[model samples]
Target: MSYTPLLQQLIEALRCLPGVGPKSAQRMTFHLLERDPEGALRLAKALTEAVERVGRCDSCRTLSEAPLCPLCASQRRDRRLLCVVETPADVLAVEQSGAYAGLYFVLGGHLSPLDGIGPEEIGVDALLARAREGVEEVILATNPTVEGEATAHYIGELLREQGVGVSRIAHGVPLGGELEYVDGSTLTRALAGRKPI
Candidate 1:
């Protein structure tokens, strides 16, 4: 029997999520329909609200509901030390380690010319502007991937031009591994053992 048009549409919509295939989408649609309708409603509502309410932090470019992210807004954080990462997930991973007490600047993404993503596309200018604002140290916590390395290098150059101290996170992070997937201890070590860029 064919699924209803609305159900099919839901499945298709779910497939747009990263790593979610047709089978996973179909299974999720069925599970949401049968086992957890209220949960699914809450999920839908939260997704809508997050998409509408959450936006990039004006200064550091991290995702925020307000003009600045919680980290940027908090006076308790070390404003002098800044950790630069590729995404909000990276920020969360570093935060989970409880190692970094400084503020963060999320690039939103890495440099990828072939993918049509450039410095302007990833808000590198905003990050450079932030770096110019008397920050003592800027940690390049981008992933160990090619694009991530390129982004780190690009930012390092910009910060060096501004006479700002720049450092790259230590190689404790597995080669080609994403920060979000690395263990907390490893992340902590990477942060603590950071070296000059």
Candidate 2:
């Protein structure tokens, strides 16, 4: 059983999406072509519009259409504090927590040397350039992965040289998880990072 050339192309295109395997792509292609072509057109139009309009914010590098993101442009935010994250999604996660009211600098990715990704690829220089611009403290909110830790350390050292206060986000067990159920590595970190009551 073979699909037409156009249908095959569509399936391949859909496979490019994250987590969309060949079977998932085939199912999506059929659903779009057989059940809802109109919906497919809407998806295509919206994706095209977003691709054309969305770009990096000049100040923070998060996804935005304007020169500066709303957080960077707002006077209400604490300009003295900056949070460095690895991606736009991380910025959204921090925003949803509602605990941080500072500006952000998105690295867009972690540093992976074997992949040929380095400070230059992740815009470390750009972030360093903004360190002296009234940002007294930089809180590293990178993920808890090894690469994320390396990135945070690298950036922290650079910022310290610029006379900026740098701090790494704490990592340990989850708020709701029981101590017995926690993994040894997490428990070890939790114990190591224990705070005074």
lDDT, candidates in the order shown: 0.90, 0.93
Q: How far is candidate 2 from the true structure (C-alpha RMSD, Å)?
A: 1.4
lDDT of 1 by residue, 81-159 (tens): 9899998999999999999999898888898999899899888888888887779999999998778888899899999
Scored by TM-score, the top model is 2
Q: Which stretches of candidate 2 lie over 4 Å from their true place?
A: none
Expressed as tens digits, the lDDT of each residue in 17-115 for candidate 2 is 999999999999989989999999999999999999999999999999999999999999998999999999999999999999989999989999999
Over 4 Å off, model 1: 173-197
RMSD (Cα, Å) of model 1? 5.8
Error of 1 at 192 (Å): 18
TM-score of each: 0.83, 0.94
Q: Tell me the number of clashing residue pairs for each predicted model.
A: 0, 0
As a TM-score, model 2 comes out at: 0.94
